[model samples]
Target: MPETTGDWAPADFERHGHELLATLRQHFELIRDVPVARPYDAAELMGRLDTALPEQGEEFPRILTDTWENVVPDLVHWNHPAFHAYFSTCASFPGMLAETMTAALNVNSMLWKTSPSASALEQVVLRWIAELAGYPGDSDGLLVGGASLATLYALGAARDAALDYDVREEGMSGPHAKVARIYTSDQAHSSVDKAAITLGIGLRNVVKVPSDDRYGMRPDLLESAIARDVAAGYVPVAVVATVGTTSVAAADPLEPISEICRRLGVWLHVDAAYGGLFAFASRMGGEAEDVSVGDSLVVNPQKTLFVPLDSTALYCRRRGALANTYRLVPEYLTSVHTGGTFDFMDLSPQLGRGFRALKLWWVLRSFGRSGLRSRLDHAMELADRLRELAVGDPDWQCPAPSRYPLVCLRYAPRGGVGSGTDLDDLNARIVKELNDSGEAFVSHSVIRDGYVIRVSLANIHTTADDIERLWAALNHAAEKCR
Candidate 1:
């Protein structure tokens, strides 16, 4: 049948979808052939498709053709094997399928009454994630867009619990507003500061406690800070500890921090956005790090859990705190299904929660515990291999060892980081050369004030060969610069 300008038939939709699938099949199979991202300027792309809005409907095939020809080239292929930049996230086959299903279903999972299956599945999926993280399966939580919002929600609950006044009902504009303090390690994600700001806890009130030599938060220092704040008429609200910090993947000593928070009567929220799932990959038999030692904890599935973008689960041990902080039902949203089912809207500011549970459920189902472990173990091994390569090579150095699949390396050559060599610029140029090579893409970070190249190996498609190639490229760039 010819292309239709009118409403397309289901048969044609199916055919076009298959065509797109065939294209994606080749795209994935031959992903290595494509660049990680086109290093072209916006003007080049903007100059190409600068046409006005479409006046009439186009055929599905033409739309597909346009997408493949015009759109796919410019996007950064995070799924590419060599995309080791940032925390590599993989939208697995099952995850993509789940996305399609979710979009088609268009589930508004705010309340149990809205979509019973969505809410029920969310409860199950949240519990499954908590268990995987070695957290309490009985913990109450909700899926959020990302860990940032999760932190905000968790902090909101913490604020409500710590404050004697009803900050939610009575605005902080009153003279009764006192300096409420939120303490976190210097290396924690900026989400902590953001959450404090959003919660009317004030950015100035978020104390940045210093970390130890290994970059873990010093429990003594945190205790001292809280004590000092208390003496100064400040209320200790919460402590945001990190499982894996963004800059160097340094995890704050949660056990000690949790003890401090609990003893001091302060709420503890773990920002395990990057490294919490280390538990999910391998149940630590002898060397386990339990992240559930907090009032609330957040883990991002998009980070290492083979899910697509924008999916984070915030689990709170104090279910009442989360519900109390955000629960407010207008007459319109009043649901009679409150018998046993939870209205997820009461757990956070979100009135319309997507069927994000589907993404996690499908990904979890597709890759069972053993399969997930194998994939994460693969990434971990590759990271170790890269570090080993850096050690063996005379021109490179892996200075900061990460517990996760994050490796921080700097080109030091035979000598130290280089006497008058401007090491930072050299490393930055090396990263530029690697990214410009289009063979791979890796990011950079500063550890202990020294600039270093960061290779985050978590992609499902990445292999041992890719690591070697990236290492070789690093050396090649170093050689050219030296």
Candidate 2:
């Protein structure tokens, strides 16, 4: 075989690494001055990126230069302080350094034997996450790529626990297969529906419970839906209660929903991916007690904790449910220390896992609880400032009540009594104009037949000034559109 190793010499590695580090530092220093997103024509971007298979490898410096020149401009700079679209996150410096070290180590943390330190740190970090969320001390959790996968894993555990049939051994096609139903509020993320589809639960079986005035799930409606499904002879397998909804960040009434799930003997899964970190600040207060009733809960440190992307934890009270559903051991992969030690591969669908725990550990240790809480409180304050501005302005309407750093409002001229289509068109144009202007970025959502703008203040760099500038940009765009 030809020589396969491409390891860089020590001096060369250090030189290139320092150069890359400088690039990152410069990017962050000038991030606020850059546009939140730079729209590129699909064909033009493909022209720049589409290439023939090279028979030889290119120089590292050349590759890095090409990426900086061609790829960086097309990125949607989520780190920008003015990035108000969707949920925002900050890849903190400490987290970035941890990621670099993790890459250099390149450990596959699938099994304890594969990387003992990675496995132990993962366990510790997961416990820290559970404690931070005030979850039961006995709760067990593992990290996944993102909230979507985390939801999938949690639901897999729920599926096995809720059904009498062995889904792993016998499969869903067994004669005992029943229509498994999942219930979530209309405002829940689309990932819930996706998880159902992936788990062999038909999308048609996923029921959308109606939301109350504040966009939170109505407990009475949820109970009625469960009762209706049961009356139809369908098994209510799981109910996903969202603590922080995507559109308005409305938290569902967890206590009542949990009580209903308990009465119905259905699995309760809480999707607190976006709002769970607020637990640190105590902004959630007694509302978080709802998590106590959940069989499984998902929290993403990547969302608001200044960690790098793709660090999500799925905590399950029914730990055996996950292993029973996902664990499979062949003779080749067996180990001597298998009895008490956890092989993360047994709990997740992934067989080869990266050492993602280190970044979270670094971030958590760097910020500590007090530091993180302070940042979260600052975000909440900025959100409140935006809400106050919208509520005070006659031309702007705060349609939904925000429980977190997400604010949903509409720019409604003439007290919003105008034609629905006209208002929708206007707001849509305003969003497009704002994005095109490169001043700030905010997204839109439709609620109760009215289009509203959604602004999230989750970035650590975002401040009151950024929120004020976003308001000014929105008004300017609205004026131009009008």
Candidate 3:
């Protein structure tokens, strides 16, 4: 007879499932339409969790409830429409539902035999996203936890391709002739450097090409950088271009960079962690059709899709290149059934993979392409509105007009009193003051020569009114500081 314990039994699970669903429904309702939490409760919540560990297990439901009561109240609610801190979003309803289902099924999509449907769905979803991203020609994809992992995986593929396919099975111990060099813009996310370092391609191997005035990577500068590296006998293996960079949403000149990469036979990887999805919505239409310029590409639906956290995708134009880089076959893991189905372990580093694709699939199907696109288009509209407001205001300044749904502005006080150092100090104080207030939240980042307040619009429920309230709060904070 099989041993049954705790809530694993069928009847027990059914009862718990219903109760848990009810509790979740209540929680979601409150989270979806309420102020994240009352101000001044951070210390109280932390103190409650400071209690000693129990010697025995408590009832699971009670523990769950305790977590909700104690832990959740302290969480910075991303779901709140007015939450403009950092790069974030209030994930969609379908994504939440899908996450629940993913956990319940709990299939690890490492190999075909482990979970056939899961592996298939992953491939299906990848194709769906690739098409949505406007990349043509034999592109393949696999779900990752987020953009960080996706970039890591993309570089691993680049590394394999650069090293002549010998590194996959023999590991890095073998005699490799090339000192692999990766390149990215100064404005590129720090992940590029981190990925290089983690992959044994040291940070020194990762070249930071200069960006143009708009904070975008200049292709001419990139070509010059590559030439200089080549002249120094450094093998240029990869060019990690940015579609939507971190500090500001600046797109690297992809067409020229892609042409250069093609001419040089270097692997191109575009890290569109925050901005790639907007390729589908570009006003330039045919001119913008050239953003997907690489052997591999990354898109973080989690960032823009209103998909919950921990959802990212990596795609390769040629599937064989990705699989060839990472695939390893020990005798136990070898598969003879190579008829049609794909094993995702060959494509990624994580062998024990969760069913992350389901959340995206659910969101896509639930909302359809038009529905999701509408939300994204709305975010762009909102960003433009914020830009207009900032530019129109004498007390505020929008740094530049680029892509994606963000406005980077610096608060300039009256009388030009705080023109330079004083203005920056005031802006810094303003960010803290608003965060401390806990009514409305806005994040800040320094760009170019001034301190900036970045209003990143990602939440679907955030309306023009919400943006208005956010701006009002910011002005009020500035006034208070003055």
Candidate 4:
């Protein structure tokens, strides 16, 4: 092929694109053979990366080679089959292709007029997600960067809806602002606190409702807290019910919590960042019944749906409330294309948005609902098997119930329960050893003053063999640490 006149000539583009794809293919093929997590000398790696500004452009191929040589080895492989750490993201190939195409187009779909197809596709994808999750047919949603942003946007709408005055126009400067409060489970994600802080609701006003033995929020305690706040002249603005907590993957009792919120007229936001997509796998103990009752819900495709990062959908039943909270039509952005057609900028915090819907659409299309359900079911089965293995072993104790794919277990020797060795210290040692072994990777979380290993199974490539290997690795590491 003849070279074009521009910087990236047609011939060069094709050659480099093929090289990138080939490199990715090779990496994926041998991913399982590499270390799940590896430690690198930070100073040495920094020496390779830290350099003076280049006077001129370097060869693209050399840059790619440097990335492979200097970066790939130091990464904690999240896509590795044995990566049983925090919720693993697979980034399926179809989704990757869609993302590449989206980048090539680089259309900002902030307004419908800016990119009509992108806006329409996003609306369609949002509806599909809501339908899959058993939300109301009338529910409306928008795609954001991730669950943190989604929660913030949802809480912002909730705050405005709860306030008697227009918070968007007047801000939270009035006397009434001092009395506003937000409620969430003690096990809720830190994003809830961040959202409250960003919204001018002091951290003191964020009440943490107690949890039961199973780690699910106690409805009785939540109701009492709300009542006490009301008696103290505090207006409860919103109640965030976590569907899948981070520590142990506990699903809060959403039905009772939603009922209490409804009676109290408090905005209910369900944070299902880790477990919401399980709605499609209802047979494997996934439930969306409680989620259906909430005023708003947030689910992350990036976490569980095999999509790449930054694809979170926030569904709001009260669409008017969201529009009223975030709608800002500046003179420069005014358009005659009105009614029924949505300008996404009106419903989100960002005025310039990428074409995130393309990747989500591709993921859903490639893996139909049944395919996704099958993958989720497989992960649940793996968790069950792991729990069985831990229970069968006398040295291991399963601390929490395996409601989802995340399994929490701790190392407790036969005679070391009340021995001199601190259980937390021993478990920490075991985790460190396991991570350092370069065979498999797992994370740790503290529950009830005890450190427990958190092994999450969400990567599509993980199999029974991988779990068995992890089981062996855990036993070996525990013995070595002991």
Assess the local accuracy of residue 301 in candidate 1 as a C-alpha lDDT between 0 and 100. 86
| Candidate 1 residue pairs that clash | none
User: Better model by TM-score, 1 or 2?
Assistant: 1
Question: 1-482, model 3: which lDDT tens digit per residue?
Answer: 22445446778678777888788778766653545444666577668788899766566688778877777667778877777767866688789889888999998888898888888787777777777777653577788887888888888888877776477666655665567899999888988888988888889998899998988788898899899988988778789888777788888888889999999888999887787777676442534435466788898888888888888888888668878777777788776667687778888777889988888889989888888778888888888888888888998888866667877888885577643558788889888787777667778778886788887889988888877877787888888886
Q: What lDDT would candidate 1 get against the real structure?
A: 0.86
Q: Per-residue lDDT of 1-482 in model 4, one digit per residue for the tens? A: 22244477768878998999999999989887888878678899899899899766777788899899888888888878898887777788888899989988999999999999999999999888887777775777899998999999999998888888767777889655546899999999999999988989889989999999999999999999999989988879999989889999988998899889989899999998887778889554544545888899999889898888879999999867778888899999987786678798988778999999999999999989889889888988999999999999998999987578999989989877445779899999888999988888889889984999999998889999989999999999998988
Per-residue lDDT of 344 in model 2: 88
Q: How close to the true structure is residue 227 of candidate 3, measured as C-alpha lDDT?
A: 92
The whole-model lDDT of each prediction reads: 0.86, 0.85, 0.80, 0.87
The lDDT ranking, best first, is: 4, 1, 2, 3
Listed in order, each prediction's TM-score against the native is 0.96, 0.95, 0.92, 0.96
Task: Write model 1 residue lDDT over 28-95, tens digit each, in one string.
Answer: 88988898876778998998778789766666778788888998888888888899888777788999
Off by over 4 Å in 3: 1-4, 8-46, 168-177, 282-289, 418-421
Pull out the clashing pairs in model 3: none
Residue-wise C-alpha lDDT for candidate 2, range 1-482, written one tens digit per residue: 21247676788889999889888889888877778876679999999899898766676788899999989888877778888888877788899899999999999999899999899999899888888876775677788999999899988888888778878877777989888889999999999999999999989988999998878899999999989889998888899999889888888888899989888899999999987768767565545545667899998899988999879998889767788888898887786685568788888788999999999999999989889888988998898899999889888888876779888887788744345458878888888998888888778888885888888888888877888888888889888877
Q: List pairs with backbone clashes in candidate 4.
A: none
- Choose 2 or 3, whichever is better by lDDT: 2
Candidate 4, run of 10 with poorest lDDT: 1-10
